[model samples]
Target: MGTATKAILTVLLAFLIFGAAYASSGLSIKSELKAVTIKYSLEGTPYIDYVGLQLPEIEDQISGISQDTTKILLSRFYATGLLYNASKANENGYFTWSGELKMRVRVGQMTTDVNVPTTINLYGEYDADGFLRSGRGNLTTCIITISLYPPYTIGLSNPINYSFDLNSQTVNLGEITQLTGIVSLFATTTALIVALTKDKDLTLISET
Candidate 1:
C-alpha cells in the first residue's frame, strides 16, 4: 500500500463512507424562525373579541430528529386560524372573529384531545364600547404534516409538504396572550437522521 500511501488510504475511505451515508438517512430542516408584525392594543375590554391559537412544539425547531425521534413521527401539526380566503370575511375594511382550536396528542401516557373548528383573523382599531382598541395578527396555527414511523430508517426529501414563510419585522405590540414576535418554523432535509431507538421500551410522548 505504498502507491502514494494507497492514494491516501483511498481518500480516507471515501470520507468515512460519505460520513456514514450522511448520518444514516435524510431530513435537514432549517429556520431560525423570524417574522414580526406585532402591533396589538386593547383598552377596557368588555369582550369585543380577541382570540389566538397556535401550536408550536416543532420538536424544538427540528434538526435531524432527536428527543426520542419525535415519539415515532407520524404527525399533524394542526392548522386552524382561518384566513385562507373565506371571502376575506365579509369583504369590508377588516373584521372577523371566532376562535378556539387546540390539539394535544400523546398515546403513551393518556392524553389525547384534538379539537378542530376555528376562525379568527383580527383586524384593528375599535373603540366606543367594543374592546380591542387596536389589533394585528399574523401567526396562524402552525401547519405541518410529518411521516416516518417504522423501524427507523427514513430517507425523505421529495416535497413532504414542508413550507416556511414568515418574515416581516415591525414589533411594538404590547402582548395579547404572550406574543413574543416572529413566526414560521422549519426542519430541513437532504439526508440527516442520526437518532437510533427502535424499541427498547419506547415511550416518550406526553409533552403538551
Candidate 2:
C-alpha cells in the first residue's frame, strides 16, 4: 500500500481499538436495604412523649473524565412512617421502631427503585420532680448495602458498603477515575503499536 494509505489505515485501527475500550469500561451501581431497628425506653412515672425518625438526603456523584465537571444523582427519599407514638407514651416502657425507606438509586447512567429497611431503638427517663433524668433520645439504626459494578472485573476486591446513622446527612462512596485512566492508557498503547508496525512494513517494502 502507498505511504499515505498505510498511515490512514493505522490511524483508523488505533481509533477503533480506543473506542472499544471506552465502551467496555462503563460503570454501574446497585443498592439494597439490609436492615433497620430502633428501640426506646422511658423511666420514672408514666408520661407522654413522642419519637420521630429522620434520614439525611441521599446523593451520588458522577465525575467527568475530560472536563472538570460533576453530576449528582439525587435520590427521592420516602419513608413509610417518620413519626411514631404520638398519642400515649409507654410509661417506663422500652420501644422498638422498624420500617422501610423507598428511594430511587442511580448506578452510572441507569436508575432503579429500591426499598431500604430501617430500625431504631431509644430509652428515656424522668426525674421524681417531673424533670428529665437519665435516658437516650434521637436514637437511630440504619444499614444499607451499596454494590458497585465496574466495567472491569474487581477480582478479590470487595464491593463498596455504607452504614449511616439517622443524624448523617451524606455518604460519598468514591470515584471511578483510576479505571478510566487505565483504559485510556491501554487504548493509547494499542494505537502506538499499530503505527509502529505500519512504519516497519513500509520500510521493508521500500527496501525490497
Candidate 3:
C-alpha cells in the first residue's frame, strides 16, 4: 500500500477497535430526582388542587475500557396517567377527579448525541362547578414522555416507558426517585474522572 493509503488504513483500524471497546461498556444515569417538585390548588371545590411541572434528567456516568471509545447517552423522567377515581361529597353536583404520575429512565448511547425534548401526555377527568366545567382545566396528573437521539433515529427498538399515579397517596414515588439518583451519581462520578484525567491528551470517556 502507498504510504498515505497505509496511514489511512491504520487510522481506520484503530477507530474500529476503539468503537468495539466503547460499545461493550455502558454509561450510568444518576438519580438526582431531589430536584423535582409537585404542588396543587383548587377553586370553590375546596377539595381539588392544581399541580404541574417538568424536570430534566442530567448525566451520571460514562464508562469505557479503552481511551479512544466513548458513548453518547440521553435520558429523562416522565409520568403517565394510568387510572383515577373521584366522588362527590355533601355537594349538589358530583365531583370528578383523576390522577397521573411520573417515572424516570436513561436512554443508552446513540450514534448521534442530539438531545431529545421531553413531552407530556395527559388523559384524565375534571369535575367542578359549571362556571368552568371545561376551560383548560388543571392537570390532576401529568404523564411524562421523553425520547433520545431524535431526528431520524431508531435502533434500540424500544424507548423507556414509566407509568405513575399520584392520587392514591401511596404510589411508588421511590422508583422514579431512585432512578434519578442513580443518573445523577453516574454524572458526578464521570465528571470527577474527567477533571482528574485532564492532564493527559486522552479523554477519560471515549466518544468513538
Candidate 4:
C-alpha cells in the first residue's frame, strides 16, 4: 500500500475510536437556590423582607458521570390585606404581594441567568362590629417552570418545575420571626463533554 493511503487509514481509525468514546458518554447538570425576597403593601406603605436561608454552591464536571438536571424552589410570605376598622362587622379587605426566584446555571464553562417572578393574592372578611373573623382569610400560591438546553446535544432538553404554597396557614406576620430559619433546600449537579477527533476537525463541531 502507498504511504499516503496508510497514513489516511490510520487517522480514520483514531477518529473512530475517539467518536466511540464520546458516544458512550453523556451530559450532566447541577443547580441551587441563590436567594428569595418578598414585597408587599400595607396601609399605602410598602414593605420588603428577605428570607434567611443557607444557599448551596455548585460546580460542573467534564466527565459524563453527573446528574442530568438540578432544581430549587424558594418560598416567601406577603401581607395580602388588613382590617382597617375592627368595629365594622362583615367588612372585606384586599392586598397585593409578590416574590421572586433567582437561579444560576453552569453549562460546561458557560453560565446563564434565570429569574422567575411570583405573585400572591389575599382576601379577608371581618365579623360584626368591626372585629376580624377567624379563618376568613385566603392566600394564593405560585409555581415556576424552567427548561435547559445543551449547546450541541440532540433530542435532549431538561425541564425543571417547582410549586410554592403561600397560604395563610403557610405564612403569618407574627410567626414570621420564627419562620426566619432555613426551611427547605435545593441542589443540581452536571457534567459536560466535547468530542474532538482529527477526522471530524474539518467539519466544525459545536460545543455543549
How do all models score by TM-score? 0.25, 0.26, 0.20, 0.20
Q: In model 2, which range of ten residues has the least summed lDDT?
A: 68-77
lDDT tens readout by residue for model 4, 143-181:
333345644232212332222222111122223322221
TM-score of predicted structure 3: 0.20
Q: Write the per-residue lDDT of candidate 3 for residues 29-79, one digit (tens) a residue.
A: 222222211222222222222222112222232122121111111112121
lDDT by residue for model 1 (1-208), tens? 2346545655664565454444333222221222222222222212121122121333333222333212211122123322222233323245444443455544444454554333445454432222223444422233223334533332222221111111122222223111211111111111111111211123233322
Q: Model 3: runs farther than 4 Å from truth? A: 1-47, 50-169, 202-208
lDDT string for model 2 (26-56, tens) is 4321221211222222222222222122222
On a 0 to 1 TM-score scale, where does candidate 4 land against the true structure? 0.20
Best by TM-score: 2
Q: Point to the candidate with the largest lDDT.
A: 2
If ranked by TM-score, best first, what sequence of candidates would result?
Answer: 2, 1, 4, 3
